[model samples]
Target: MILTYAKTLMFLLMSYAMAETEVGENDLNEVSDQVYGVKINKCCELNEIMVDSVCRLAELLNQSMWEPQFKTEDGIAAALKYFNYVTGVPDCATTQQRPIFDLGKSEDELNLLTDGRLQHLIHHLHSSDQIKDDPLITNTYSIHEAIAIPEVKEPSSYIHDQAKYCMDKIIITSSNITGQYALVCVPEVIINWKETSFLMKKILNPLFHAIAMVLYLLVAIIYFVIPTLRDLAGNIITTINICLIVSQAADLVRIFTELSNHVSFMVTDIILYISLLGAFFWLNSFGFYIWKTFKSRNVFLRVTDVRKYCYYSSVVWFAVGVMAAMAICAHFLLDSGSNPYKKMRLSNTIILEDIEQETIGWLGIAVFFTPVAFTIIFNLFFYVTTLKVIKRINIYGRIHYKLKGCFDLFLQIFLIMTTAWLFLLLSWLNFDGLFYAHIVVNLLQAILIFYVCVVRQSHVTFLLRKSCCYAEPIPTGEWGDEMTHMNGGNY
Candidate 1:
């Protein structure tokens, strides 16, 4: 009952105050005409004076009803000051031999009366505060007086289209560089609680990438420590591990940098792309090595040719580096002719474009993807050839169980990579649902490799036993060609 009474009392007080302080249309019209010599009872002619009249009327309304206190003289001066600052009115240009104001039809031609200029001129009015040392408008009545105005209860509609145009133009213009460049042109993408993919991108993706980096490092260390593990397969796996580490490190750096520094961010991105492409090329080497082994019909011999592997690695690395450099150059130089808003350089004015967006150009997307596409194609070809050779081996003499295990490991790695790439393609096509899956598959690759190549093998335990002097020494013939083909054999 007490709360209801308080509400009723407040409503009555507000109504009384509004009725006392309300400024009628006649008063505003009088002020407008007095200032601009144009009546505001109806829309006037579309000319300079009419525009000034509308702007002056808006300023009067804003000062009387929205401000802390009504000041007709001050409002008139402020409006005139703003108009002069923006339009340079009453000042004749020597070149044109007339007023500096150009009432041009095109937005570009009317440079002085642009929306950007108007917004900038009146940006200070966005804030409302008590007058620190004022005789008329004190702290107590300042807040209440503005609210008590009738316009606060019901919005004041403009009867004239010109007046509406005046308010509309000023209200929509941005007050800051971020608003003009980032917020205004781009369509906002709101990620709510339901958007699990965005959350995964923010948190889970980095966590998994870190975990995978550690796992890859551990596997690489294991391969290096175990002398018997340093075979053809070991060298290739170590290269793959290094590539994964570089790629993950680059990605993690890129994620945390907030994209504030353009040069460092671009460099990280370049490293990431090159490392990823290199890893896939190494995967292609997997099928190539396996297919070569089977086709030679030398099942008993392990091809641990260091020189051959070095040559292949050098070629792959050099090719990947060249392609990446070319792609980066092409991306910046070529123009895709996409939507101007989509492109980084929205205008010739460099201040208006986002730094990150400007650095990452759109045209070289296909050029960069070209190497990935080629690697995937070759990966498929090598896998198919390896599978055919495997079928032939199965039909004839029985293959060693250890060799088949190595092949299975290779196949798992290949599938993981291919599936991750496919998911990336889908996500690129705007399949938002697959975004989390893409991140998970791409980031957890090293974890799977560590599990299969290190944890699943008895090599680490065998080495530990040997170091502690608690295991029987291996027979001389046992560490022969067959053992080399095992990759990581059970002790």
Candidate 2:
């Protein structure tokens, strides 16, 4: 559904170019400005028509949803209106004609687009690369650039609002400086991701709650989840450190807004990418750890070494750690000023998209499959080595329940959401399509995080809290007391 709309938008944009050439009665107009008077008069007429149409559509869409209106629908409809306007659909005053008024000399004829005007403006901008990319018109970059330009002298003000409030301030101050060829994206990706995450989280709670109860019961037997005993802690810590670095890289964005230098922002992007490499390693580590716990026969999850992969399966974490002791000796110092976004295909580190992104995507699939392979291997061992052990062992019952508790399909939603985000990021990096995928993933990730967080709180929280707590240490591989009791079917 979404891709179809995108192609249709692209086709319409190309059609507009052809339409502009043929629309003149003599078929000889060289520029949009060659035909004028109707620009002002028709712009007004189209504005009025669209506002009226949207107000009516608003009422209809609201009625269909059975309420005054939904915030989500309103946002989508508004965006759709802007998209429609940017493309300059037929009969829009914008399509018929548009006026470029001089701010210094002419009366301000640019009426801020209301819903009706939105359709005309967005359609024009969407189809006309000239309109959308022009910094003076509606480009996303112009705003990004403006945000980098600073007015407030206070340091705290810069850090707090950079992501949210700062962008708006920059736009208002930017006025006419926004150049053409700047709008990088529209919010198509932003809307869809938000909805699906909400839907998944809503459905996963009951099983999670049941699982958590089982985990709390198992706490008397298991000392801890196996992943935390060794390298996994370091991996999680590394993930956190990279996040801190990314937060630090964020300073360059502020510097850009303050000085209006695009270079600083570019540097910041470099740092972000470098940091993401670290982040991805830890995330993969955590994902694999969780996979192990869910599938392990002993009900204790152990972290496996990811080394010995076919290719760049992430070797940097260990190499970097080995060199960390040299930091005090002037080796491997922090490159606070260094741009991490600088793309490189280092021989050792596995990049997801090393001209071989498609090949690496398979590794992600393999990362997913490692547990399935482990499950088969372990289940067979459990049958041969531990099946009779269970008959004699009461604690063995806890093992069965907690193992089931740890791995739920409910948990996969987070992995799925992250995978989608990763694909979107890779695609954007490759410049396949923009706006649609990123926006969807960003919005989806947010919703997924919230849903997953809540589900974790309600269901898995018990498992995590029980494991992390200092209540007491217990035996490693036996069936938990709770599991043994539950074997009596008490649960």
lDDT of 1 by residue, 389-425 (tens): 6676644432345455557667887777777667766
Deviation from native of the Cα of residue 383 in model 2, angstroms: 21
Best by lDDT: 1
Candidate 2, position 367, lDDT: 34
lDDT accuracy of residue 377 in candidate 1? 83
lDDT of 1: 0.50
- Predicted structure with the largest TM-score when compared to the true one: 1
TM match of model 1 to true structure: 0.54
The lDDT per prediction is 0.50, 0.31
State candidate 2's TM-score.
0.28
